[model samples]
Target: MSALDSWHPDSKDLANLAKERLSQKEAQYILDHCKECRECADKLFETIRSQPIVGERRLVKKQNWMRAATLTFFLAAAILATHWFLEDNSRSGQFAIEPKSLPDLSETIYAEEPSTWFEDAFTHAMVSPDGSKMLHVDSLGVSLVDLSSGEDLRAELLLDFDQVMAATFDGNGRIARFANRRRDMGWFLESGENLRSTAIPLDAVPVWAPGNRDVVWIRPPGNRIVLGEPPDDRWHNIGDRVLGLAWDPTGAAAYGLAMSENGSASVLRVRPLGGEVEIIREGLDASALPNGLAVAPDGQSLFISLATEDEPDADARHETRVNRDLDIYELEIKSGALRLISNIEGDDFWPWVAGDYLYWTHNEYDASVMLIPLGNPGAKPLFDVVGERDGRFATQLPRWNPSGELLAYTVGSWRLADWGLNLDTEVVAIGSDGDRGPPAALVTGYHADYTPSWSPDGRWLAYRSRRSPRPVPYYAGPDVTDDIFLRRADDPDAEEIRLTDFGWEVGDPNWSTDGSRLLFDSWDRVPGVSKPWVATIDPEHGDLLDVVPLKLPDEISGSVSGVYSPVSDDVLFIERLNPETQRLWVMLAAGEVEKVIDFTSYTRGGAAWTPDGESIVYSALVGEKMQLFLVPRVGGEPQQLTAEPVNVLHAQISPDGLWIAATRLSQKKEIRRLPLR
Candidate 1:
């Protein structure tokens, strides 16, 4: 056995011996070594004859079949798996940042013919109540549209970097709001005003009531429900940011959904406006009710849409298809009774209730809107215009008008999805079943776009735009700039206007409380060097040229990620102490730098301020892996949110601030959420 184990074909001198015809010198050397080494000599000869020769009938039959069998098995396996092994190994190879190719078109030409360089990757959209205006926000800026004609109204700068937050329309469809930093909210009302705003003793994300009367907001720790006031202070918190939150039609009650450590569904807490006696519902998995409450006209019961991940798939390749259906539930506020209304599948998310209809989106490989009648037996498909409503390579974020008669959604694309494809995005109108038609292409770009918010009246829409980076060589590499834009929803005769030209890159545009102003930030150029700069724009003129650079410390540019306050319009960004040690910093809407709080010392970048603007959630590198960390903006220790070894990048705050959605790396890239405590 030892001799057989020791035998290796490479060790054989048989080739030399055959070539030299058993030369005396070589033969002598082999014999000498063999005499001293019993294993090599015993196994060498036997292993050689195992080839099953038919010619040269020399009567020498050597024997080590064990070694030959073992070697042959391994070789066969290697050959059989060669293609698979090569493909697998090839995917594992290091990914490098290659230089980007810059488009040769002039910036003006690109401005006039937006899609000349960008294909429609617009992902999310919002339409005004009157259906005249619409908005789209993306990696670029805020875009307003005139729905009557496919014309750009205004393109305003929203963020200086990538936006990871969801945009929602106010109940009246008159204002559009998005989460900025903690305690901050960006809102745009009917007046087309742009502002970075917040209320005193700020709340979490500001969610509007179904009637658009009061904004349902969150207050941390002791999650309290406050009524919406002027400067906007109706804040509430549901403990964890990952919890599900929903508002009743009357804006009277707020529901919180959670899953316990045991994987059992739990109704963490429920708060009714004005009267505060928290209600708890237990015995459930995770609920799909992020802003899920839509009160019945009688006010006797609450209708909510609930969803839960069924179970892990048997095959890992099918993981993307894991969370499929939504279990629509009806819950009674006074009796604490719960009943399943219907079992609907196809990735139902962010359901909006309008009159007798429950409107929600179903992502079946492709995401589209569907309306189900509460009084009827079935649901109706509003449109199959995903590619036309969205873009060729699209991601969906839809918002409906107060009446639910009209709907608007945002669309954007991934880098790989549009790698070689040409596309465009449109804010479509679906009056009823089979009424879907080609959407009004509001924004155009060579790269990607998203984030659509509609006014309460459905007459106006606000959106953001981002041009893909065009590489210009620098230091043996290349530089890229992703720009921001905005347009009007109603003025289809108008053209989109470029917002920020600083070139540091921009994203995530939000409207102020009254919609008279828009607030967003700009990221400075340089990989480990960036800073947030706030700007003001004239929504009607689509003038982004009035940007006034926000003041910051010299170190602000050392390393930063762009962001803004969801409530107050304050510009929020992350500053780093080198590539690690990220700090959450905020600037007032007036271009004044305020506080700089050291959040996490993680050896990584990328931080998102929670909807409330009290704490910032960021990504941290743990060991050789990256995870999510939540740090207070007031300066405190950081809390690790995720324990996975996978890398989490570009984390986004949900509209209600209960969930931290992020891009997770698996076999391919996937979006996941982490609950905040």
Candidate 2:
């Protein structure tokens, strides 16, 4: 073999390169040759392509890439840039190009290890049965992407991508099934080299029987399970209150988890045609039950990532924050035997049973997708590196640049436990490109900074800060209130221009289309009351012109936060209908009203407008995690994005409309394995 052909970095080198443990001396030699020889670039690109890495692992930009050796981090940094070249992406997106350099990787480089398939926030990735393809679903829609080529083989777009939920690959891997929140099922199938789809219009999503169209579904409200074929009216009741569902590889029987009214949970194995339910395991702890399930290839075992049975202790007299501890469990189908597969402190969830291994999301200080052997699965080692959240610092409300290169978020210190009383909070930003890092400090000081919004020109950023000159009286006692302020994005020492006056307790700010104004709401602590306000600013000078309250139609009631569109004159805002429900409404510049559908979420930072102004990206609860979703500006179905166990507090589209810079609330989870022997 030729020396140039054989001397290439493998996956291990790439991982080590990402962690900056790879030898930089050798890495420099390989890349210097790659720059001059097209053949060498091709060989290195092939190795980079074949690496078994997925999920978002952003490279840390360092001076070493330009000064010293070409490290293996270039292998990962080259991943999307190569795809961008083949696809000819417009302008600049995240990882469009790497400066070619190496080691000294930081925690920010691989902080969020998520799907590498979709560039934006991808919620779910369902690999095919043959493991040759993945059903890529995100806020945009669903597409069948080739695993090797990174090409979209098939796509079935249905408006907002958030509406596309609960997607899975069928037994043959040619057909895919998906459902929307409180909507019907839509089928994406491959027929004679063509992609086609049909709306099932059923109330609940149906889990397909192994090799056929027959499906088993759990009805809502009472959580009743039913056996039926789509497009037909007749259905047989299988069971009720199913928590999770799965089918055997042989298609002989189906498995489900049932939780009773008494808070007891059980696992049931039901015969498909006859609807005979056999209780495989009963009286499992109902608390922290698993949200997903998978059956082994042999059809003799089932796996689940279950949370600890103990409930989180409630705080004495403040906002309640539940810290749920999760682990993995396995059950033998024949013997009705149950075994704990994982005993880690962090969360190990979303188990997918493959041939001889079980893969899951392992999260601790950082979240990663990992797998372990089914037999003799030794204890999976915990992530030794501590994250920013592992310390007193925890991030919330992340906003990113349109290029996906920079992320701006709030970092605050939590004493005892975060009850929103931390006064050490500040707005900080990080970069994905080799930009060293974001500006030293966007907004910092004794005053707490929150809700940062970027300007259209990327020159100025607006945020809400608790920097009132005098103490404002909160409900309980006197406390520093919030006001709108603007700071230059590129300058750390620039004087911030205060937008709102001293008295008003302002909300988060959103810049106008031309960067001439900001839209926000006042009155943060008052419940059931939201008043819209606008602050005018000069795009060229970054000076606050004036601040005024906006008048709304009389019919629009409830606590409404004004979220102006980035690309249009329309005004988009969210109104809290109740403690559980929120209504998204859009008002045209011509005084016409359009009401979007209502969604439920307790953890929210208000809705944000997309770059195109056609859809608004927002977050709502999917299971226990807060994920990003999209609703059309004109009013239609909302598409959901992001499916990790982590919560996305905020997300926004970039200037070029090329990326969705999501601000994920700082969280960590990892996948691990437990022995079944």
Candidate 3:
């Protein structure tokens, strides 16, 4: 008080006061005098501002109590903030403050419910022509995301409809068009504006004309292309066998691919509004059916996605078609010269051209958004939406903002028709004879349960259940920690017992011949990388017995898929010599390993032991489909079992060895979109 009352405090002293370094008495003395002295008050104010605290400066007068109170409040707040800053910086001496910048474009903007699974069809997303908003739709509903406000403005619209077939936005993004489950087409304008609804054609594909002048869609019954607004849209019957459609960027013309009357092949045709129809190209390959079409910005060329058509064989078990070999081609409008654009290994479709880049979606193990520079032959993927092989999960539909600064796509895995990584599997048992009563479920629940194994006595069923939510490297359906579970074989409703809890993934549990112990594969902290070890568990009490490592040659490091021999004390498993080669091996309980079968030419799944244990049944990719094959335990020419077009993921012999139980799968996927930085 003595120093503050007689002389003005220095700048350092004022800074310390704002930082709460001065005693309470000294702080109060300085505050009291600053209200009467404008020069000293301004100095204290500048000192507080320079101290890097968040607050505003206030003026005070000797008699103004409110102004004095405001000043006092700001000083206290600034001091508290300064204390926290200093404390944090003291712990980390290298702390630094960086100026804020624009949001990182590399980061992704995902949906509110960012799951790993999706519905059967493609979930579409589009950006407003003005780039101010984005529209996303799926089985769940529709969402209109406002880019500027970072808010989902049209969440209420999603609740009003059960399913939205498609959605498009006007040039300004203030108006939106939607086709819903009731075959009704509607427009939603800005808040306080009236919403318009009317009946439209069902299962129609909606497209917005350039500049949002009018809406065009492919109507059914005659497969005619319609133009104009709902209830008054006019049909343009250019051809009867229309396969695909595209519109010019200026909205002056439309293009379509139609099959010839003879049905031998397809031809490309173009028609200007109210103008005569003209054939652009003819005699296209019939086996390579056109699935998607898009016109370049200059309107001089068109891009098309062609999928190899499937032709069923007379046997009803085989279909001749290219597996994931869809290709993209470009056609010049004037010259009518068609050239291939993408000749990759996967199925490419849904083309969109913007600026100097051509974007499309490719589906293989999972779907990916890909792009290539215009006039450049090489193409690369930006990211994987869904997958298991390489840390990719399900994602679809990618659209670019008009400004081209942001991109949006959807993320979720699409389940296969019968079985896939997306479905929660159950265990069912049927009679060995072809004729029997209705099959019954042996193990069923909300959780994913599969890979069922019957104990030697057939009294207990050992299966894997994904109960814990842990993020796995691939297969992004649900966070799964696969654990072994046991249930009564005879009682479907009986309470199940948990057999193992090692905090690691465990699967393929097989019982010993006597039903006393269980053998399974687990990826624990082993010495070598990419190798899984075999572990034994007591079937009676679920206790870990021991971990047996496969001592293989130096070139052969990885081993997995272990199953106990029903006839001997040997463990049969798959050993990998490299990424592309794997062989079946039998490891004796007495510590010796022998190669049983070579799987170098084809990819293989889990192998099953027959009732007599003389042979093994496994699934392999022979040609275009995954089929079942049988081979003797000692190894020889493999015998093909099932030649169906479907993939046989796993096969097991019935208890009586009369019929084989197998898990069959067929897969399909659609694209989606989300915000990208």
Candidate 4:
């Protein structure tokens, strides 16, 4: 072969060179040779055309061969620039591009169609009080689905909020109360209506009364109960340190779970319209954490959802741990006597009473709607609602219409472990100085992209993405198996190239300093067993070069975390010795491993090495909250960086050392209503 002909660049390398990611000299040499070589020029043109193009471009006149070739090169460069612009603009605003709202599939699917219920991991559902319509909420916005029409009842009232926390329909189903983390708003369910919102104090839980016209919510700091109306209404305090609330059927009285200074809890009843508060039951030894409450139809008893203490080895890094023992109890209003009602194996809460039945949600690996006759507490659930796929399905917030003919609840494939991955998460870029301009989304669609690692040159990003068809099971924990994807840091619209797809759990991807190898941890052939490995790949053709398994200590078997050092040929990783303890280890590129930092407490992965590789930044659970800490690579006392209440899941130091890009867990769940048979 001729000397010039032999120097052919692969598709990936050629695209990088076209985008100017290569050194100036390297890029110029390729361009110089392509100008005179027809074969190389044709190859380059085909590569550029194969990539995802944003918009259609008219071809230049081919009458002049040289001019056409030059125009082609410039056109490719322009396409890359356009992709970056669109990506940057989509994520710059208060919210990501208004998610293309989900369409009502009920219209297309017949009622008798088996397995017709649409399933989503991030959506919530709740039936209206009257049961004629249903309210569906998700990360994109709030949707009111009509049962009879199988369409959105109020399309104009579909409030597209970024993160919706709680949503409820009033007794008349005319007004709805919805709260995200920042604020709570009242939505009139009529057509073409706007939202009426009010600022909620911190740590306060907002609840709607039976009338739906009045809202009873707790005020933060002191936990004072307040009742107010919509549109800048006044709030009146009724009780103090209330942990939970429930309104009576008559709407004249409301009951609450109150906590004492010494950690004891009690139930109190009060009138929202300025009346004396009565202690229904005091000195109850129940745990301070109460999830939900509901008053008996006859006003003789109260149903409360309480959680037992979590196991010592439970991983708190997740939004909600698996197998969190929760149950519902019945308390006699007059005698203060309590009895367990439902004790299924799962995280069960959100109890709702309708007629003679008590309904609640059971959340294990999947979520299901469970119900039992109040008169027969010892009997099993009359029926459990689930999706047809047999995958990880969840059904929560069960509500019955006034007639009780149709049951409505929200169903999805996501469980508690999938919370942070599915909703309100975006790979945001901030300056090293913490000047967060407009955060850009790393990827868009139904799938989630997380744990982003910048390439050594800062021109590309490698992250783990959950785009597979199979749903992650609940017992598997939050560490899900995903395919590794790579995309240009600047080109948002460019198609992401998939690297690894063995169907094994993979995460914490770290790029080598030379940008030719990727270091990550993956589960072995056995379930629940994980090991660290390094893979050399050709980014130019998106081909895997070789896989090198690191020699791990015998004690380290269940799960391990690894990252490539930003400046050296070494890899830093954390290996769990047991459920409660883990140790930091370092390994050379050749597979030799050495223990570095011994950690007795809970430490999560996603640790980042400092630019100089002398220190590491990671998150550790300190006194119930996950905080950022900086530890020396050689091992010493770690320095705490942030002490806020927010939980930092992943932190990455910028290439320029000006910003720390982190994925913060702010709000986790939202409520919605779906129809059940």
Candidate 5:
């Protein structure tokens, strides 16, 4: 390199070699060829002086060539040094790109190590099968962890990704499955197969079958129980609009839960793959259970938990109807008999089977995870918790290991636990060891993070984040929008990528049938002024593509709502009808627009398509309260998804298309989930 720049590696090596091979004087002579070339320089100068005798053009050309070569060497050296330094800075926790957004979410989430806010706000997490691997899906991507060792397994499985919504473990837990904004499902194993994915049809969500025999996935006609069969075109709809399916190795028959327009919950028993729809229990008043049916091993009994109106709350912030109570019932599928189990007087939901015991989480006065013994009429407290009765943290979901030996749950922002009042939500694990360890902080930061979904592989997790404590404005109006984030399941390192930063506010992001993309609605503005824009997002990179424009602005300002098309790359959007009512419209990837069937009168705010992509599911305000509706995507009269009008909103379809998980309004704004079946 020239004197203007640093030394070149080749030059340094040459000098060192000379020093090692020659005597000091000789080495100096060899290395300092330029400095010692005064005679040669003089000869060159004399030649240049005689350039007039030679040619001006020749002399100028030679000088230019020498200068060009020297400059090139120096420039190359500078570039190499800079690249090396940058790489080192990134590894040392110093390099960062000043993102486009003001008050970048990325900076705040990864601002510190073992960050208090991000750590505690873990809304979702996926634990691997052997219980060794764990994955945390956040803005950054999917974080893998070795749970047995409590160490980060990989820095990231996906890069620059956001909206990791759901994750699970396969049979052995060696492979982890995930679903993101795209509603696509992905599987990853430790071997060579990475990013092995089976796209859940845009119409249905796929859930793992018992013992990994097949996956209970959704399609147009009904629910499909797909075996461990490699993904192909084979999908069977066992029934018309089959909502929920549960398998108990102890039971001779599998049970399904369904809801009808008559405000009745029906329990159906059938064989594993394809069988007769035998109604075990019918016409049970109250809607479907939040958590699906739980069957005992002996097949003699079944437990179904459902929600109902309790009493009025005078202290409620909103001027609305009174609260309701949730009840758990034990029924004899064969004898057509039933008896009440809990009826916990509050919001009861999330039922799971653990050995001979039945477990569930409910919100009576507050959130609590309760347990009941199938063999014993009365059982002492297996576990109980009190959580925030307001905000996203108010309604909570508890998770249980497949073995049922370990029970895991979350405490919301306002939760009052034995360990003081939790200002942020915390994820805690309880082993059968009777030893309840300290709460493991999941997500933390300036926002309220909740609604965690675990992947099948147990190697990754997905969740959503909400900006909490209200905004303390530094600017006049908000410039950037709220998005999703991610973290490592084992390590303290967390990174957040932007999912939505458009001018409009986006909410209720759902993963596509596959894990690669996310579906969400971009609300134009506040209610009464804006339309919902249906948008598709890249979960790994937070890049959003406007799939459906609600109004189809002539040049600049249209709106849309809903998410991905039930079957194709197309999207479902709600178009405004002269600002009075909203209608369903389908926007294909090719930019083709077609109006579908009407959902209901003045349908706004919330909408979704059934798992099979054949039916359009949505929530509409009927009279005073909002009711659920399911209509054919091709065009048809809308069918009610919910019977009673209890102000239901923010509803989402599970991968299996068996249940509708949503936040329902009861007493204290409880979160309730029910079977679509």
Candidate 6:
């Protein structure tokens, strides 16, 4: 279609415009029409999104380091997260970074990692109140170091204090750490030359008070305040998610913000002596995230940051979801008056109140701390972590010393190589036979792309991708979400067309034998339960008809992925008995339980049926490596495929047995530090 009939551009012409294949005159003519025609404008953008995003994606691997995919693509790799496996899931909590809200980092010096400076940095470092000493934990174990003289004062390797959640110094500069044990989690404090442990909840960071009473703290994964001291420890139900807690100057009571069941919060006052829980303010609109706290130096007001619930994102596929970032606010302690302090574009939380400035870290593509005039919105950035120049390093987790004299944070070389938890992943095609050689990148971009299922005829492919409008770094938040996308299986650099936008995690994508429908599992509307979802599509035009979960026989709750058999009417899937228990089961055509395979699988990219439907192929962690395993339809001991030391994820053999299209991960990481200023 040209400018003769309805003056609309077809998909072919739109592709040329997106790839800059059209001449200046021809392109200008189409642009002039698109400005007036809403349909054509939308088509042009859709075509652009379909093209291969080589600008920020890498298509190759290196023996050690990555070489850029495009000449202009500075970041070739970063992210490989065995570090976040299972317990440290990147998608466990819900947090989102709006792509529109993020600034393009290639043009700026933010989000890039300065891994070089932190190649061998310690994982945890805590500064004392006077800044005279610091408590650090490394492979050698927990040790106290004198920052000035560079002297190792003491070492506590047997204690295993590396994973301290929150450590605060008492008036005597003693550190309280979570004591990791088998039975329960507790806290241990350094009393004189001896270590004393308490039964207080490990997460509730105790504030050392007089009479050996450590009061004030909220329990994690819940909304309860742990008060009193040993023997008579009291757990008070706040009935709200506590955001920030700050102690008054007199230390008589602690003031904190606790978000309610709905999208509102209240300011609370807890007196340790009388166990009095008072609500200073209630029904204040806010988002239950980004915990923050700050008491003015003069003890006049309390500072906090919150995202109001009313400002939901319009373009979001998830309905009734707020997309606003956190902003700072000030509350007068005595008068109970609350006022907005800073309403910036990004997240501003965990405030620090100095003499004339209020310091808080701003969350965006760039990691920065801002210092604004006392209770003022107008502020200037005091320190900025710029690492994109080399794309090898990143710095974050900045904390102020007790005296507010120095800022302490860590720089990491721990680039997940774009293949870890929260990291970017690309759909790569590998040959089943070793003769077919190395894998080739397809549908490359700066988002998490995985779970590829080739069409029956091998003309098209269906996969799940967390493709966002924003440029995702090594770690995209859980709320970023995975959507279904279709691409040409033969064409490695083909345009990718999105199918579904449910705004939650999608998994185990499978293309039907007839290539008419795409089936995958989702945890969208149903949080814990994993239901198989199906969508009909047009292979040529990539038109999505509708998406709905397939109702199978029996209660197959919390299923992993369901794969259709080529020969019979059987579906293979993994059943989740609990968080750690995964059992393999097959359902026949009439919804009959075939056989429960004893093989336990914690598979990723999902299991695939062989071309003949006789054997099942899946990836499993064997000796710390994700290796491919083959199991028979009848069940028994599964056969192992490859034993390569590297990660081999999402492996599936082609129908012709010529190629094995699978995914793998490579990564590097370390830690270091930077000055506050």
lDDT of 6 by residue, 526-555 (tens): 577788878888767767888888776675
Q: Which stretches of candidate 5 lie over 4 Å from their true place?
A: 1-163, 173-176, 179-196, 199-203, 220-240, 250-253, 286-291, 297-300, 308-323, 354-359, 364-529, 532-677
C-alpha local distance difference test of each model: 0.43, 0.54, 0.50, 0.51, 0.42, 0.51
On TM-score, the candidate that comes out on top is: 6
- Give the RMSD in angstroms, all C-alphas superposed, for model 3: 26.3
lDDT of 3 by residue, 194-237 (tens): 55563445566555556556666675543466766666777777
Give the residue spans of candidate 4 off by over 4 A: 1-429, 468-481, 553-559, 600-605, 646-649, 663-677
Give a tens-digit lDDT track for model 2, residues 273-341. Answer: 574568887766433232557787667678765444332222211221234334566677767666555
TM-score of 3: 0.38
- Candidate 2: RMSD to truth: 18.3
lDDT of 4 by residue, 350-385 (tens): 555543334444433333333322222343322233
Positional deviation of residue 470's Cα in model 2 after best superposition, in angstroms: 37
Error of 4 at 266 (Å): 35
Clashes of each: 153, 25, 19, 12, 88, 21
What lDDT score goes with residue 507 in model 2? 73
lDDT comparing candidate 4 with the true structure: 0.51
TM for every model, in the order presented, reads: 0.33, 0.41, 0.38, 0.39, 0.32, 0.43
Question: Which candidate number has the best lDDT?
Answer: 2
- lDDT: which is higher, 3 or 4? 4
Candidate number that wins on TM-score, 5 or 6: 6
**TM-score for predicted model 4 compared with the true structure:** 0.39
